[model samples]
Target chain A: MRIRERIIETGLFFSALSSVFITLGIVIILTYESFGFFKEVAIVEFFTGTTWMPLFAEPKFGILPLVSGTLLTTAIALVVALPLGLISAIYLSEYAPHRLREMIKPVLELLAAVPTVVYGYFALFFLTPFLQNFLPELSGFNAISPGIIMGIMIVPYVSSVSEDAMKAVPMYIREGSYAMGATKFQTAFKVVIPAAFSGIAAAFIMGISRAIGETMVVAIAAGMMPNFTFNPMEPVQTLTSYIVQVSLGDVPHGTIEYRTIFAAGMTLFLMTLFFNIIGFWLRKRIREAY
Target chain B: MTRSAIELKAEAKNLNFYYGPVHALKNINMPIERRKVTALIGPSGCGKTTFLRCFNRMHDLYPHNRYEGEIILYPDKINIISPEIDPIEIRMQISMVFQKPNPFPKSIYENVAYGLRVRGISRKGILDEAVEKSLRGAALWEEVKGRLNSLAVDLSGGQQQRLCIARALATGPRILLFDEPTSALDPTATSKIEELIIELKNEVTIIIVTHNMQQAARVSDYTAFMYLGEIIEFDKTDKIFTAPSNRLTEEYITGRFG
Candidate 1:
């Protein structure tokens, strides 16, 4: 029995260690490639410079445009998703009849199953033209279309997580609030939402990270030029798309452009890491004993 | 029995509650007097809590498969079970303290003030006054006053129960329903809650579900003994305790059977 227990303990230890090793491996690769790029590019210039035309004859390595593009699309996506997803989550968890909730939840999750490429094509082929009529500033391939599609893609994550958090709250608490003569809306918003604050906050932050990390949808529809403008109508190239564009071309494996994309990958990784840290902190620090 | 002009705060007549197809409460008929404490005592699964919950229509949260009953609330005399009557509005006038002390993961001040906040009472001075009054009413003011901003979960179990009571009272509810509020507390905390219930009878009509016979005898003006989803006997506390008209009530109160 003791030998069997020791074997099980060793297996669990390796399982935990594997994740740490994988993370260290990715960080090492990112640091190695990005370190090589930094030798040619100044840190200040990478952060402050506006253009990101690494393929040009006079290669400009300012990463701000790509960062801004990533921020813009992610912000738009979060703006579209956070409230819509949270409200749907509340409705599904708190208001919907149990049978209806069961029926609708899987269907809402079905949105996540659609390939990101399909969402990209749909944004490029269908929504961009449709939106162009209303907002004539919209181009054939713009951040707005993909931002909206990415928001649609991420609704399931926000709703599922937020709904789970809200549901995790003890039912009697909501009942207590309702017993005080609070309307369903008031109980949901004021009581359940506040009780589930950490969970909902974490879900929202994860949504931001997911939106920032989303690739194919933005790559297909958000254009190729890394424009720094906030105008949703203007085309913008996010970090993920830039990496995709560079990798698709014949930039030699050891070339500066090849090294440049890794720097961009490192930046995306850092931003996602930062968001996740904040989310983890919130979830961990919650004073919810009940 | 000089009860010609006594006003009733709430009344339930031929009320039946169902959980899907299972009848949880069968034909409950009772009248709640204003400014009085009524205690419902019964064995587990005898529908004591279900009857107390019907006062505020708590089952309305899951309206899909809950109840079939007419709980006629006095003053308005509105049929609380009717589809047209908003349970939201009914809940505002009636508040409940649960068996387990379920305080929100918030500060003591916020926990007590949430009910007032829900009613759109945003004035700081008013909320402060109301929170203080309610906490004091629940007998938790002196203990919690020094650090009202502290998270309520930091409090002891007894204090959490009082905080829940204060939360219920903060709404200035005309009627307060308690479903075994003291069942989770220590004996000392239980007595404190019992004393608070006696004091609260001056302001609000209260219906309590308790397994503790001594608690009911001490706190309640009226005692109801229930069995199998029906009230076998309900009478003045002394009469129910000393000489219950029903054999089951006498047997149960005498510790012969539950």
Candidate 2:
């Protein structure tokens, strides 16, 4: 019996060690390439400078445009997603009957399983043309189309997490609210929503992280132009798209230009890390509330 | 008995309830008097909780929970089974305290003031007075007064239960239903809640479902003994304990079989 237990314990320990090894590998790679890139480009200019002409002779390596584009698209996606997602969650969790809830929940979740590439193609082929007919100045590949598609892709993420959070709220809270002569909407908004706010906040932060890490949809629909423009109608390039653009070309290994991709990757990694920390903190707050 | 002209609070006539073809409450007929404590004592699964939930129509909130009955509240003669009368409105007049302390994750002040706030009572002065009054009524004011802003979840289990009672009292309902309110509490907290219940009997008609036979005898003015969802014996508390009409009540009260 002790021998059998020893084998099981060894197996569990190795599994845990393997995950740590994988995480160390990623951090080491990101740090090595980032250090190589910083050797050629001053870290201050790379972070703070507005211009980003990397293929030129001087190769001014400011990455602000890419960061700005990423932020703009993510902001637009959140604006479109947060209200629609929360409302859908409230409806499904609180108002819908059981049969309808069963049918609609999976159908909504099916949107998340649709490949991001498919969403990119649909946005490029169908939505851009439709928007161009109404507004001729709209670019064929602009941030607006991709951001809207990304918002649609992320709705399920927000709504499903928010739904679970709302569902986890105790029935007694709703009962207490209802017993006070409050209307159904009042109970949902004033009582249930406030009680579940931390969970909802965590969901929103998770959705933002998913939006930032998204690649294929932004790469396909939003053109790779590293211009410092905030206008959604103009062509732009996000950090992920810029990395894809660099990796597609034959930039030799160990060179500053090649290492710039790692710099961008490191930046993306840090931004997502920040979002995850915030998400974890909000989740802890929610658990403490319960 | 001389009865006053005051309207009947709640009346159940030949009420039968079923949970998926299993008879849970059978032929329950009773009248709840105003501003008095009525205790329902039975073994587990005797449907005391079910009968208490019916007073506020909370049982109908779930699907596939059916009943063949008429529960009427006089002056309105409202049939609880009718779809016309709003369940929400009926529940407003009859609130419940659960077996567990399920207080919302809010501050102590907000926990007591939740029901009043939901009713759109936004005046801070009125809310402050109501919160203090309700907490005092539940015998929790002296302990929680100085730290009204503290999170209610920080309180002990007994304090949380008193907060829940204070929350229920804030609504100022005509009837209060307790489903084993003291079961989750310790001995001292149980007596505190019991004392509060006795004090509250002069203000609101209360129906308590408890498993503690001694608690039933100690706090209740009227006692009802139930078996298999039927009220086998009901009388003054002394009579039910001393000379119960049914053999089953005698056996169960004497700890022969539950």
Best by TM-score: 2
For candidate 2, give the lDDT of residue A254: 82
The local distance difference test score of model 2 is 0.87
- Tell me, by lDDT, which candidate is best: 1
- What C-alpha lDDT values do all the predictions have? 0.89, 0.87
lDDT of 1 by residue, B105-194 (tens): 779999999888988899999999999999999999999899999999899988999999999899888898999989899999888889
lDDT of 1 at A77: 92
Q: Ten residues in a row with the worst lDDT in model 1 chain B?
A: B60-69
TM-score of chain A of 1: 0.95
Give one digit per residue, the lDDT tens place, for model 2 in B1-258.
234754467778899887877889999988777787899998898889989988787866677787777888865788775667778777778878989887877899998898888777889999999999999988899999999999898999889988988988988988898989999999999998899899999889899999999999888888888888998987778988998888998999999999
Docking class of 1: medium
Clashing residue pairs in candidate 2, if any?
Answer: none
DockQ of each: 0.71, 0.52
